[model samples]
Target: MILIANSEAWPGFSKSIECLRRGERAVDALVAGICEVEREAKVRSVGYGGWPNMLGRMEFDAGVMDGATRQVGAVGAVPDTLPVAALAREVMRRLPHVMLTGDGARRFATELGFPIDETLHPDSKRVWWERLQKELSPEALAAFPDIPLAPLSHAITDPERVRDNTVFLGRDSAGDLASVTSTSGWAWKYPGRLGDSPIPGAGYYADSRFGAAACTHTGEMTMRCGTARTIVLALRLGHSLRQAVDLAVEELKDLRDGFIGGVVIHAIDADQTHRVVSLNCEEPIHYWFWQEGMNEPEKRAAERV
Candidate 1:
């Protein structure tokens, strides 16, 4: 049995779970699916050619988890590595440590046959240069004091609003649970700023036997409080996935400063009961659910009870 949930988009993960039911292992299929999406989606947060850093360079971060074995692997602050999900998967297979960062992560990727190149895509390079110009101009700085232009100076200079925080979850028959989370971090972020995306329990989590996987968006706050883990634990306490997420959100709201982001929680009980919860302040919270072998995914929206 497998289940997944996120803030906005669901097709990629829903499709990946369908592939897994056809006899593929959860870890392999999920990672591969996410990698493909990361590359093709080109959403400026995940994958190559999307966004660059304040220094006009592209970097990536990703993580994978195996719930059955309780093993985890992650890479942070990596440069020029496409298919970062694959690298995170490799880290799980090759390294004993749970996390790797910076040059170490890059070295691991190279050892696994990944190419590191200095030539970034033209679009991303141009975005980076424009950010540089913004920083050089004192008028620009004075205009947008709240924008972290200095940090995210390399990519996504435009002031844009992101709606739902997308979360994807998948599980396999063998009860192997795996999750992959990739992001370019915040726009105009500092050169080496790492976000919740690459951090397990913040961006994603899985428990193979218990049948749960979760991922989060709007990282600035969730990363500080282990939001995913909190939701999972709430579910373990016999709360429905929706109940758990609601509680977790309430708790996080109290603890948070002005930070904002969203979370997607997926859980399957031992009885094969499944549920998903998506929470964000931008709009009403949302939910989804499915049982084992079910073909259709159910949907619901949050409203004041």
Candidate 2:
């Protein structure tokens, strides 16, 4: 068994391996593992205290994939719930649909016994205010309290500051692979904006035949390129794991509309060998991984592009 996840999800590594060691299905172990990350208050880009939207509300998004069946479930713009990862799993298991969004997602989560709260933690709200202040002068903000922040307008806010995504991938004893991705979506975004996090084959993908791939960084690039799936497909077509990731990173070079600050990809081959790749990243990238015979999860730096 093997588990690989973005470095931000380090808190989940041990628990995920434990679930795998206990013989849980790859999907189950992956979900169980990410739940720890989602519940962690320190990771503000994910569940719970994640950066809020322009309206000061925390909306979350998550996706889950089952490699053996190629099935997926996703939830977007869900508010006040840290269990969206589990909810995505429930959607895959109990619902015929692949996704739910906004109020519908929140309603479904509530029906599934997930908590619903609109109150942002003080620290989270403070973070929101600080970001807002970066885009608006104190006088302008006070004069137009009802005005919505427009991140798309170069004259307004800097959207780059809000970008973040997280991912987790696992392969079970039988070699079945599965993946999960969760994010608060773009910070200070429009009230109901949805990103690649809840988009299948965008945020993550897995196939028992070739293995799994998942990513963190620019969601729009992933959504446009189907990056995670692209990596796995490259592997299926005979590219080495690192080569597959490199091809995906190379594709990002074609992006011309905006700056791609960074991108990090985590991949695991059918043999359970794993590789992490980072493209144009400003700092060193790291990821967490674990397998049988390992006493604890290990953190390793990725190959930088």
Which candidate gets the maximum TM-score versus the true structure?
2
**lDDT for each candidate structure:** 0.63, 0.82
lDDT of 1 by residue, 78-146 (tens): 887767777888888887787788788888888878887552567767765665665556765565444
Error of 1 at 225 (Å): 1.4
**Candidate 1, 131: how far from true, in Å?**
3.8
Give residue 132's lDDT in candidate 1 (0 to 100): 62
User: Model 2 over residues 53-102: C-alpha lDDT tens digits?
Assistant: 77778888999999999999999988778878899999999999999988
TM-score of 2: 0.92
Under the 3 Å rule for N, CA and C atoms, how many clashes does model 1 have?
10
How does residue 245 of candidate 2 score in lDDT?
A: 85
Give residue 281's lDDT in candidate 1 (0 to 100). 46
Global Cα RMSD, each model:
4.7, 2.2
